[model samples]
Target: MEVAFSGINIYSKKPEAVFEFYKKLGFRVLEEVAPDDKWYGSTLALQDGDNAPIIWIWRQSDEDNSVVCNHFVFSTNGKMDEVYESIVAAGIACKPPFTAVWGGRELILHDPEGNELLFL
Candidate 1:
């Protein structure tokens, strides 16, 4: 058997803000479902001119089924520091870059909805 990771789904109360946050990180919208419609969500990917999406952000509602996590980590192509600086400059509260015990330089921050994210 063989498997490959495609993308992750994120549930957020502020889906638009989350989408904008990812956009600032250089991710482009692969697809987006307007909030006025039944399924409100968006798929995003690194803007390397590829069609592969890396993350999906779904609008959460009182009736929606979803899972919440304290944090998640994303691997970077050695631009972690630059990304971290950019995010901080944007006025978002982000921890300074530091070496992770798991063996990589990492920076931590929270999304508009308070979901912690670690960039490695």
Candidate 2:
């Protein structure tokens, strides 16, 4: 089968809170699956300008899960600064969104899960 980039596995300690964070970035939860239904995790299906999902939050295990997958990048249509300011204003500790070595500006946030989300 032809393959394309699907989504990230964001394992959260407290997924409900993390879900709110993504909601600020405009990711709407299309469908939510319970832990028992899918092994201690929730598949938060979200959309961002495309029908396909670009990010996912799978809350499993305990708080010790740190920095899942180095980092995950989310498209923001070049509004990095705005997104950064918004997150900062909300009291979420994060570095100012800036141009990355990958050639796109992104806002880096370390969620309570200790996992980093790069808002590009």
Candidate 1 residue lDDT tens string, 1-120 = 786667678887778888888777667778888867555788888745444547888778868656586576777779987787788777666678998888878888777766778788
Question: Which segments of model 2 are wrong by more than 4 Å?
Answer: 33-41, 45-51, 62-67, 89-91, 98-106
Candidates in order, TM-scores: namely 0.73, 0.60
lDDT for each candidate structure: 0.77, 0.65
Runs with alpha carbons beyond 4 Å of true place in candidate 1: 47-53, 65-67, 100-104
In the range 51-83, model 2's lDDT, one tens digit per residue, is 475556666666464555546666767776777
Which ten-residue region of model 2 has the weakest summed lDDT? 35-44
Q: Pick the candidate with the highest TM-score.
A: 1
Question: Which candidate achieves the best lDDT against the true structure?
Answer: 1
Structural RMSD, model 1? 2.9
